[model samples]
Structures are given as structure tokens and as C-alpha cells.
Target: MSRSKFFLVVLICSFVWAFVPGYLFQSLTSISWVCWVFSKSVTAQQLGSGMKGLGLGAFTLDWTAVSSFLFSPLISPLFATVNVFVGYVLFIYVVMPTAYWGMNLYNAKTFPIFSSHLFASNGSPYKIADIVNQQFRLDTEAYDKLGRINLSIFFAISYGFNFATIAATITHVGFFYGKEIYHRFRASQQEEPDVHTKLMRKYEDIPAWWFYSVTALSMIVSLILCTVLKDQVQLPWWGFLFACAMAFTFTLPVSIISATTNQTPGLNVITEYVMGLIMPGYPIANVCFKVYGYISMSQAISFLADFKLGHYMKIPPKSMFIVQFVGTVVAGTVNLIVGWWLLGSVENICQDQLLPPNSPWTCPNDRVFFDASVIWGLVGPNRIFGSNGNYIALNWFFLFGAAGPVIVYILHRIFPTHKWILLINIPVLTGATALMPPATTVNFNSWLLYGIIFNFFVFRYRKKWWQRYNYILSAGLDAGAAFMGVLLYFTLTMENRTINWWGTGGEHCPLASCPTAKGVDLGPDSVCPVF
Candidate 1:
């Protein structure tokens, strides 16, 4: 395929990834009442049933077990917090930055980050090229081995540090240069007024205190009503109302910021912290947390930010949306297939029981266990340092990881004459990649490839591309996925429901359902039994 055509196809798929499954899932599961109420001609009941079934199947295979493992007290608190927080932060700051840095560094050192690779015929395979060309081929045996590698202390420590450092770095950047960055972007933009004018306007624009008081009081009442009538509720009357309120309250500021700023260092850091803290806690609630993490109302807020930025920058919203959508779909599709295949391979290896007892692959749950153990396990004599102190070394490592660019900048200064020296640090491109245990090597590799493609082709080449677009795309996919996830959670737990109204009137509501409601049946019940 031609480059543009290929790009277009990929972009379309990404949009589908952003909109399709997530919207379908949300429409059917959480807010099916919209279709039922507005589009009365359609059979909302049947659609809801079908969606519920699909959600159940997906949840059963993917999220349920992982969620349970996450929340289970059997998993140490420290481990849970570290892994979850790290994963959340990395997805935002580290993954994108590392990918962009690696790709750009590679381009700067060797080629242009934006130029088409199809024109070059080096025949020499780069790390990213090898993975992409191989179609991410790792046999079941290799996958299992990789899974084992993923579970190692090295992988845990490296990834943990990478995430923590990225979080700290982003936070620090916001603290130091946030206002400066905002002003710089604002200065560059042709339409925006100066900082003082903007600040005065913001003060004038904000609603009166009484307005906020009334809104807060209304929200409290709504929360109470939702809590009281949760089980008795039908479709999403309450949910829709709540969502609208949330969108109006939160999405507006995000949108306004996007419309005004070229860069939002302050908001970015705040977002990273919020995402980091909340994302980990999500899985503690249920598997749907993962889905929601990807596609909740936060996603809508992100989308508005992107949309406003695109609008202000004179970029076509349609084009930006399409590009983001295509990238997400491509990445998600590859991730799902590869994830499932590798998971199967790991399962097989575990069944054969070839690895050591605590190996990550053989013990899939070891990620949680190791994280928890490392932190909470350092009790008694280790209490001198405090529970947080055990992670001190790891934290330093993360700080170093976040300072990756600065380190490269220093190298550039030292070797001002020797340009190639900057390339040596390119191996940090594989920082997260190297941290993956053998079992999950395939999955991590796939993710890395996606990151590289995005950074090199999309971010680097499309210099004028609004950064908010990336966040919006991420949020949209996450929101869509999350809505479906919540629906699936209700289906998996809720029982004895009536269908007269949107099939949501049920006796056993998710809020009231016991943690052990689904029989506490982890896996086959006979093997790897849950207590």
C-alpha cells in the first residue's frame, strides 16, 4: 500500500478503536436507556441483552480474574499500589516520551523522524522493524519463557522506577516551568490575549460562589438518590443525568484550556498524578476499572481538551480525530490478539508447571505478590526505614529514568563535536521493553512498537499536531471501554432482573453483591482454586 493510503487505513481503524466497541458497549450496558428513550422504534431490551452477554464473555475471559487478583487482600497492599500506579503513570508520561525520544533520537542520529521509511532499503533491521516485520511472532514456548522474564525482579524494579521517575519528572516540570510554558504557547498563538488579560477574563468568567454552592448541593442530592435507587433504577436515567452534570462541570474547563493553550504543563502534571493515583485503585474495585481507566468521563474531558486545542490551532478536528482513532484501533487490535495468544501460552506453561514456584509466568499473580511483598514484606527490622523507605532505591532509579532527556542533553554538551554519542543512550528506548519478563515480552514488544510508530510517524512528523489530541484519543478509548466495563460488571454480578424496563431492574445489585458472589471460582475451580 502507498504510504498515505496505508496511513489513512490505519487512521480509520484507530478511529473505530476509539469509537466503536466502546460506544457499543456503553450504549448497550450502562446507558442503554438513551437508545430506549430517544430511539423508541428500536428494541432496546434485545440490544441490552445481547450487549450484556458479550460483556459477560469478555469480562469472564479478560477482566474478572485480573480484577479479583488486584483487589484481593491476598495480594500485598504495597505491591498493588506500586504496580498499579506505575502502570498508570507509564502509560501516560513514560511510554509516549520514551517512544518519541527513542524514535526522534534514532531519526536525529540516523534519519529524519518524519520521513517515509518506505523510500529507504537498508535491509538492516532495527529493533522496532524486526518486531513489526515478524508480525510479532513468538511461539507458545517463547511466549511462556518471555512471561517468566516479565515476572523477574529486574523487570519489576526497572518498570517500577521508570513509572515513578516519569511521574516525578512531569510533576517537577509543571512546578518549575508550568506558567512559563503556558505563556510561551499563548504568546505563539495569534488570537489569544496576553496573560494578564486572560487571567482577568478567567476571573470574570467564573460563576458566582452562589452558583457553585447550588451546583454542589444538587450534586450531593443526586449522589444520594443514585445511591438509594441504584438497584431499583432502570436503564440510565440517573446515570445519564449524572454524566451530563459531570460533563458540564469538568469537560468545560478542559475544553477551555485546550482552546486557549498550545501547551498545558500544569494540567499535564496534574493529570499524570490524578491518573496515577486513581488508575491503580480502579482495579481494586473490579476488572471494569481497567476498561473505565481507558474510557470513562475523564476520557470525555480529554476529548474536549483535544478538540479545543485542534480548533484553536487551526487543525481539522476531523483529521485529528481520524488519526487518533486509527492509531488506537491498530494498537488495540494488535494488543488484544497478541495479549490473548501470549496469555494462552503462559497458561499452558503454568499448566505444565515447568518453571520455579514463584516465577512470574508460572505464577501469573506474582506481579501483584512481588509488588506487595517488596513493600509490605519489609516489616519488623525493616521498619526503621518505614514501609515507604523500601522503595527508596527504586524511587531513585525512577528519578534517573525520568531524567533520561537531561542525561542525553548532558551527553550532547560533552560531545558537542561527536554527535553520534547521543545515539548511545538510545538503548534507554528499551528501558520498559527490557523490563518485561520473558512471558510478557511479546505483549510489551507489541506495545513498544505501537509507541515507536506513534512517536516517529505521528508526533515527530506531525509537529503542529496538538498534544491534546493524543490525550483525547487516549481518553475516548478508555471511556468507551470503561462504560462497557461497568455494564459488564453489573451483568456479571447482578441477578434476577426484570426486562419490562431496559432489563436493569434487578434484585441483586452490583453495589450490594458479595465479593464472593460468583462462587469465588477462580479458573477451573479444581485447579488453582480460590479461597
Candidate 2:
């Protein structure tokens, strides 16, 4: 095909694929025979949910991926992937098991090995609304009866670690770039000259006023949305402005870190922490506020990154802006549609009982998001990490996180010849532990193992061969996995068919993954219905 024709075909196909499964199916589920066919039996429903869940997981990986992809073209792909590999080992193999088994914190074994779902002391799922009074504050009487929130030691560590990393990232930037920051602050027009920036000098710069106007319009819309959705989201107008202010202030430093290190600090925990203090007792509002704040800032950075990439490639600024705007609108709409459909269709999303045995739609990420809403949103951190709280000791992790990098910096100065000292990034170490609730140990192990083989063993011994085939091989494998998954879901699963085998559930250690018993001694009030 000609180049234009090929591009046209690609665009058309992309839209069709995104729109069909996302919008058409979502809007026409009742009228469509496919939904009926898929929803016919217990097995079919489970399979459909599994397929949707898998598709979502695969796509979500691409969020962090594009930035890394940009890095590979500019630098070494192997280098970035290796960094990720190291993280998987530190968290999955080292931190998690040690915290759980060695420490016996939060009676780790009694609950699900890796779940974000909060349980009462009696072992049932904690219902926040049940304990709230008319004023939407925590009722001491009801809370005592319901029991306090229980967190796995892993979760507690991750929480503390996250806070520490945030502080560390800011400190790392400020300490290293204090001179440049001061220069910029003093209104110096001095620009850092890089080859990429120099190459783009011929193109006309996009106006700053255009960006400011767009930003102002967006803020207005955001304020309106927050106000209108107050009943559901509970975020007040003032809270919305506060979120926007936080996003605006943090975006620059966070984006700089992301650009240089391929590691962007998350604002979720920090946003939640501040909002929790400011808007205490309103869990839903806190979550909404955090999402609006953090995600908005992230989107801005992503857009800015794309603009930088476009400038380097000599793409017209107007063209880049248009494509980005359209793509974001389409992608965002499709995501909402698909997400809504799956949540509506899937039975027992995060809950275990009503779900089929080993249902893939366990909603690990959703569970985490929900739990955060409860912890930072419903029951404020003051209650959980306060002196009187059950796991107040976990608060020390923040101090550890902050002090860790400073110690590393000192070590680096003392042992100036050692390059490895620079690799001891406290943020990356904390990030490794961040995935446990939403990811399994098996995934961590497999990813690390593969990264080692491809990046270390093969790259070391067979540099030429690795360069020629590594990325192509990796891409082909990922494509094949996703293609086969969709194929199987449609051909067999949607028809209520499955290969009834030992490994069909995709779990190697079922008993260790989630709690098995029904009552408090076993873990939470929620029982493992399948067991």
C-alpha cells in the first residue's frame, strides 16, 4: 500500500477496534446478541470478565511504557528495562515475604496474601457507610462495634515508603538542581542547550498565551464538574481549586524527574494525605480530589513530553497539538465506556464469594483504589497512623525513605570511584513494594527472570544478536499473548467453554494467595466461598 493509504488504513482500524468493543458494545449490550451469549452461563460470565480484565491490564502497561519507549530511541532500551528488573526483585522477592512471614505484622497469613480490600478485625469487609453518623463523621459507637481497619504489613510498608520517596524525589531534585532553579527563579533567560533542543530551533514556538487560555478553560470546567457532582463525589468547589493548585505546583518538579530518570513520583499518596487532613471523614470526596489533582498533573506532563518529542522530530506544533487533543478525547471516552461496561457486567468484581473460582476479574487495582479511599478518605491517616492506632510503627518508613538517599549521597561522595552507589535509588526500592496488592509474586518473578535473561545474560554474551532481535522478539511475544487471549475469550469463553484443567485458573499457589477460612481467627469476616 502507498504510505498515505497505509496510514489511513491504520487510523480507521484503530478507531473501529477502540469504538466497537468500547462504545458500541457498551451502549448496545441489551440489544446485542453477543452480550446475551456471553452472559448465558456462569462460566461464560467469568470468562468474559477474565478477558476484559486481561485486556485492561495489558493496555494499562502502556501508560508507563511510551515514556520508556521514547527513552530507548534516545538511549539504550536494555538499560531502562534492567532498572525495572532490579526493582521487581527487591520488592517481590525481598521486601514482601520478609514483611509478611518474618514479621507476622497485621497477622498477615490470616488474610488474603495480596489484596487491597480492607477487612474488619472480625475478618469481614469493612463497610465505611455503616459506621458514619448523620454528619458524615466517624461514629465512635459504630466504629467500635464494626472494628478497626486491618492492613497487611506489606501495605503499611508501601504507604510509609511512598511518603518517604516523595520527599526523597523532591530533595534529590532540589539538591542537584538548586543552581538552575535559582537561575530560573531570578528570571534569567539562560537556556540549557542540548542537541535535541538545538535541532528544533528552526520551528516557530507555540505561544504561551494559548496554553494559559486552555488551562484556564479547563479549570473552569473542572470547578463546574466538581460542584455539580458534589452529591456523588463529595468534593467541594474549594477542594477542587486546592487540587488544581497542587497539580500545578508539583507538575514541574515531577516532570523533570520523569524526564531525566524514567521514574515519576506519584502524587496519589501525597494528595490523599493532604486531602485526608483537610477534608477528613469524606472518603469519596478525598478520592475524587486526589484523582483530579494527581491525574490532571500527570496528563499535563504527558502532553508536555509529547510536545518535546514532536519538537525533536520536527513535527509541526499545531499538528501535534491537534492529534494529541483528538487522541486524548477518543481514548478517554473509550476507556470510560469500556470500564463502565465491565464493572456493570462483571459479577463480584472485587468481592470473592459471588465470583467463580479463580475468576480473573478479581479487580486488584480497583481494590487498591477503593482501599485508599477508605484509608486516606474515610478513616483519616491520623486515626490509622496516629500514636493510638494499630500499626503506628509503620510511620517510621517515611523517615527511612527520606534518610536513605541522603546516606547514599554521602556514600557516593566518600567512594567517588564507585558508580554502583548511584544505583541505590530509595524511590525505586519503594516502588518495587508498591505493586504487591495489585500484582502477584508470580508476575514479579517472571518479569525479573525474563529481564535478566534478555538484558543481562543475552546482552552480555551476545551483544550483536541481542541488538538485532531482542526488541522485535519481545514485541512479537507480547502481541501474540494479547492476540491469543482475545481469540480465546471470543471463540471459547464467550460460548461458555473452557479448558477444565489444573492450571486454567492461572494460580500456582492458591492457598497462599488469599485467605481460606471463614471467620476472625482465619482472617477477616469475608470467607473464601470457593474454599
Top lDDT: which candidate number? Answer: 2
Cα shift from native, residue 102, model 2 (Å): 3.6
Predicted candidate 1 versus true structure: per-residue lDDT over 1-531, tens digit per residue: 444454445445544543322222222223233233423222222122111100111111112122222211111222222333344345424542353334422122121111111111121111222212132222334322322111112233434544443343343344334687688778776766755455444332423564467556756765665466543321123443534443444343333332332211112112222333332211111222212222334455565667556655656545666665577679889989966886776544443124532222444434332232222221111221223222233434545545664665666687789865433321123232222332222223223233344545566677455243544443343444455446543664234232333232321112111111123332342221122
Each prediction's whole-model lDDT (CA)? 0.34, 0.61
Candidate 2, 1-531: lDDT as tens digits: 444454445444433443332222222111212223543332222112212111111111221122222222212334444555576556544665676557656776555545566777655567777888776656767877777888755566667767776777676666556678888877655667678777777667777887788888877987787777667768899998889889988888788667766656788888998998887778888887888889988888999989878977888787888798789889989999989998898777776546786465766677788779878877887778765468777767677777777888889899989987776666655654455556543334334445556677788899886766665554443443345446656765567664445324332222233443334344354323333
**How much is the lDDT of residue 85 in candidate 1?**
32
TM-score to native of every candidate shown: 0.31, 0.76
Question: Which number leads on TM-score?
Answer: 2
RMSD of each: 21.7, 8.8
**Residue 436 in candidate 2 has what lDDT?**
52
- Residue 47 error, candidate 2, Å: 28
- What is the alpha-carbon lDDT for the whole of candidate 2? 0.61
Worst 10 residues of 1 by lDDT: 52-61
